[model samples]
Target: MTSSTPRRDTLRFITCGSVDDGKSTLIGRLLHDAGAVPDDQVAALRDAEGRLDFSLLVDGLLAEREQGITIDVAYRYFSTPRRQFIVADTPGHEQYTRNMATGASTADAAVVLVDARKGVLTQTRRHSHIVSLLGVRHVVLAVTKMDMVAWSQDAFDAIAADYLAFAEAAGLPAPTVIPVSGVTGDNLVRRGEAAEWYAGPTLLEVLEGLPPIAETARPFRMAVQGVNRPNLDFRGYTGRINSGVVRVGDAVAVSPSGVRSHVERIVVMGGDLPQARAGQSVTLTFTDEIDVSRGDVLAAADAPLEAADQFEATLIWMAEAEMVSGRVYDLKIGARTVPAQITDIRHRVNVNTQEKLAARSLALNDIGVCHLSLGQDVAFEPYEVERELGAFILIDRLTRATVGAGMIRFALRRAHNIHRQAIKVDRNQRAALKGQKAAVVWLTGLSGSGKSTIANLVEERLTAEGRHAYLIDGDNLRHGLSRDLGFTEADRVENIRRAAEVARMMADAGLIVLVSLISPFRAERQMVRDMMPDDEFLEVFVDAPLAVAEARDVKGLYAKARRGEIANFTGVSSPYEPPAEPDLHLRTNQMSPDEAAEAVIARLRAARRLTASPPFEQPPLT
Candidate 1:
């Protein structure tokens, strides 16, 4: 092996393909051939006959060794004189597709192993699609098992042609197809006896010749992880630069706040520096004291990224649960974490066939095109332009688990269309004019659960007390405001969303709004709570047994739902996720509607939410 070359650069790549495609063997062979593995470790990987077992070198986990399958992404570091390398050996099973994605996220290149006998399997295309989706521009199709195919020229050529066609169809750049035998160490570090017809650089050669990353030419962007203020005298904004260069005195903008300042100093571990470039983890001192904190993007003033809340994106559903539209997720992109929701699922891609099929939800390992609505406008770019700025991970708000990996395609046009218009008369001014505290009491439960009856009673009592109040009844809203919505899960979420928004608006207009709806989904209920200010929104769970509601189905709605005539009807076809904590929990069976309404009024009075007159002046009792 040639080991003498200058100007070494580290290239990060991952090995992935269908099961038993020789990915771990390929990486292990590279390590062994390059003298990266110690002599003792090499000895440990040998069988009783003293022959090498290449998979043993990389599949170091006990379970992996026993099962002979990779369960986790095993990262291996090695180097040649020309370049250093970080090779990730990813699993091939569909269940571990998320592990493969995690490995490929930061990769500069991908080596997708294809067994000559199997040709292009389903997972081979899956890995290729994911590699391209992750913006790994350099791809190496390692057509392995030349020895098993007896070094047949036709076998290698056929597999290579099919893969090239598939890659081209998938909009991936043409890959460098190398015929190799990972088990025999053929064409790994050097050309071997196999594949006499093939005349191409070895896998290591291709990697060494791959283009070096040119981050200095890109726009300056850094994701702030923290504000390092060890003492009040010295403060630094610390983060790894994603792209471009930042020099002292350079004008910078901190987003999504859009605060602008000049870089007064650049501090590295050694001391202060004149400048800092991409990939370096350094701290920056700004000329002006700005609110530059964690989750903010420090970008160059001239070419800052666009701040947007809505975008069209490609998402890889990593969770076992399917994608739930309107469910709020904590989207962690770069160093910033924001509340985000998948507003729409346009279509899901059949990875094996590359078909964009209509889909309502994305299952595990499913790649889909969806629309995302973030809580706040933040700096971002299309993933093709900048992976760091455009890539994100969706975390489950309740479970705190990472559910999906996403790449922003582009900011939706509606992101620009929907701008917050500041009004002169705010909610406080409107509340002051009404001379009472305005709040929303959202009643939710099963169908025929006395929500409407209790809401009417509450509104009547409020009217008698001369309180400005309005009730947004569910059926009335469906007749006018939500007339177009259906009873599907998505439509139900939208229905409740519209109702909550209207209730919030009414409450903002100095009116106590009572909303009566069977908003079954807890996610949408929580979404509504998030829309209003704390304490302004009160969820009133109109509790009633399913049997009780079904027995009292005066309109025969529950009977229709049981007969399957009403599809997606809550408590029958769909599900009702009860709130873990509701402000008011009313057992309708135990209390009459009048009693429930009075109890709610009592709660408001106890919380001091009701307007109270001045107390009688007490006589001076010194």
Candidate 2:
């Protein structure tokens, strides 16, 4: 089913940028000039005495008033006769980056404020990155405080040029830059006469002419947000229709369970509705007893939904905590929450320059590609096709905090894959089988410094001691688990991520897992460690000199690395900073293999991980 008409008349836009960029002042001017604000509010602005304490107009929070900054995303509703506007004034401080994300996440367009005096700063680039990442279709780079630069067209042009260059590099469409004086009410709703050199539509005129939200003609797709059980006799699946249309008597498919049935009835908030189109929140009753619940999307039989356990997505890391691979978090899409693990990080985008940075892990406000695997198969549509079903949020299970936001690019697994294993055994039993408690043993070192060899030795020793053990060697893992990975900084992050997950699973089974990886970056290694319990995790450093490592390169990786066969390769092409603190350190070059193994054994014994005595210890009895 499809609906060709647009339902909403108004368009929503958000203003985002670093603090003191005059976002609030610009918004206030727009509202005042458009006659959207009430007479009383206008009087308040005038009484505040032409100084235009713009923060007072929209900064609703008392804390915001005290701090003279927008603390939260403040929504201001106003309308011109031509089009309605709902403006979200987002915070600018780096600490409130997540708040900025929350604001722009739903906007059709964004007004990215840049100080003309300061030009484009790092925060300006960051906000632009976030706007593009969030799928904001239109961007207006409102260069504020032209009065600071004496409304100089040359100054405005210079800043505009710099921003344009950066935006092109960041993969964002060239933004329309308007040189405006927010405090003086120039080039906002009304074109001020000050900019004599410029002959362009005013900011409000441009905003008013933006294309209305386009309607999609895709098949009927609605994700069940909640089960509406008003009484014992009535059972309905409630959610907003993501695309197309839904009507009674239409054949539908329930995913990921894939049960087929006919739509018995369509119900709206008021009562039974004749039909529901995209963007309308409604409920539906099916003819058969399908095992449908939250997280499941219903689609027309003609265009059935695809089910997959893994998918690739573009993500904006909004948390202070870095995005590391193999870390498990709850993914919330629509009304569904599923356990998810990041298998790989593809690359980080440099927003201003639109260049791809080789990133291992994404810090706060970083944008990257990630390969994600759900705990179970779920139905999803590509973001380009259907944004409602494709967008997701990563929530930290422990803190219940949203750490990242994602948009599905494509599904990795097929719908009919039956190789997926269902949860059967208890975790306690699995842990008992492994000798040591299951925990992630994160190994970080330089390439060719013996991390893999030492990890192999450790695993062998644990296995011989009758303990279950698993080895997630960095190289071997890349063959299958991270086969699609590369050696870029971002790729390396994903590589460690997949390895970390395998290690996490082994550790959960109470296995003495050894991860021998030259996880050169400190931030990435710490992320792996954070995923495991304190007692179970061991950060083992395989310390050796660059010369020693190069001399012992059996794989010729060092040789190739020196010749630059690989870029961002640790110890050769890239820098490898050894861990300042580690659970255990073994100078493999100084000590023999046996001596190094004994040292590991000694450390494990001291940690109460092993009962075996050192070789020097002898039995006193008999």
Candidate 3:
């Protein structure tokens, strides 16, 4: 005898597409027809003009109502006699694409809406690709607003064929196409009489019939979140099980350390459990006193996970600041955190056309294939195999803000191939050979703040006094090394990174290196400070108010910014963070350029950065 598949009781899904695709209306209609909406709440959905507006039900925010658009992901719960449903109505605007990704991250299915009049748009394709990337196997292409097209079968067939072709090209599972009018309730609850010739299941029928996604059969994995010891009587490791099942006597291995142990007991809120399955929150008591702490993964001993420090991943840049290669960030997966960097960008995918485009950096909402190198080995699995162990977020270390989301593909072999090479000639030897202390004088300020002028004067004064000095001006280097970069927040970070690296190299060669740049972000400046020894880097804040800098727009850049001809311009469109406690502060309004140079020279001498044995002479102020 054959057995029948079990019926799923709950469905999790999201609605996404281009702006004004009737997603809100479709959800509101579903809730209303299913009697999910209360009578009093239904009465409250009317606008000031007293029009029957369904979208007012879910557009709950004041900003959303005023703008007449959804800005954030809004979740709604409703149920039918056969099944319960949780719907995430994600914003369709291009700027809020990150929020859509966040909503789709946990969904088992997706309802991608498309306006019958608009057909398939760029956002439609973008949302489809994201749903596929997130592992949502079941998809519904809701061709909404069928009443506008007179319920024409030809129009519906054309869109369905186009989407199927796109799905094939993008390697996404084909979606079930449906013709419905969300506003008029055609083919929504029960098939309306709008289309007489068409005979298909209603939207609710298709949704209720979708099978529940099967749980992964992979070996047990749990990230240790906390060590619980109410008293000396008992000790347990507390965390939510990520995959598979664990029993009381199950043998386990701690990853990244390779420690082996056996579970003695499993404790839950109710009591001790003989076994715990995936998604259950429980604590386990170990039979042995092995070393285990937070940020460590405990897995089934039979199938230990791979420990690696490097992997290739699909990255989605989420910050307004673009992504910069070679910059370290906090890579957080489950409970573990490691310092990581995107070493290289291989390519970016064009969502609208499904084409691969070469890219060096990723901007906001950009998806690309990149290489990540971690500070230490971590237990990981490919996202296709296990989501909790493979999905991660990139956090800006200094700002303590999330900047990107990534899905690990696989570990790379070249990670172990690269090793640090040591040399006999160190910094001390290089400094001794030049007969002077090596240091980097970092100058930061707003545009036209006299930083470049003061830096040029300081370098000239040092060179005339028989000392080796070099000036790494920001603008001059931009014409060469950073020529490919722009004024986005991410590019600004890279610009400073390249300049600081060059300055460090010159300083290592036993020369005084002066850097003049409008390094606006405090985080970037602090990163540069942490790169060298305590006394080797000095931050000089060339102070000038925004009014003063705008008045002295030497290149007419500020004027262009005010006229909307330039964007991300500091003190205009973007922001500039001044140093909180600079090593040297120069108020250009109160001191001449020569006076500033002399003050810097005096400070260097006091710090022992210059010795008198070299027969140094001070340059005249004139």
Best by lDDT: 1
Clashing pairs in 1: none
Each model's lDDT comes to 0.88, 0.80, 0.87
User: How good is model 2 by TM-score?
Assistant: 0.69
Candidate 3 lDDT, 1-622, residue by residue in tens: 1366444367889999998999988988878877999999888877689855778778888988888788889999998877889999999998989989899888888999999988999988888888877778789989999999998989999999999899888778778888998788877787889888678888888998998665647689998998898999888899999888999889999988999999999999978999998888999999998888888889999998777899999998889977888677889988999888788899998998888899978888888899998878888888878878888999998778889989999999886577668887888777776667898999999999999999998888787776778999999999999999898877887898899889888988888889999999887888788677888899999998899888989999999999999999999999999998999999988898899999888878877888744445556547
lDDT of 3 at 209: 90
Candidate 3, superposed: residue stretches over 4 Å from native: 1-9, 45-52, 229-235, 396-401, 419-521, 530-538, 542-577, 583-622
Candidate 2: stretches off by over 4 Å: 1-8, 46-50, 413-418, 421-622
Tens digits of per-residue lDDT, candidate 1, 454-520, equal 8898877776666777999999999999999888777777788789889989988978899999998
Q: Is candidate 1 or candidate 3 better by lDDT?
A: 1
User: Runs in model 1 with CA error above 4 Å?
Assistant: 1-7, 47-51, 612-622
- Steric clashes per prediction: 0, 11, 0
Error of 1 at 331 (Å): 2.0
In terms of TM-score, the best-performing candidate is 1
lDDT comparison, 2 vs 3, better candidate = 3
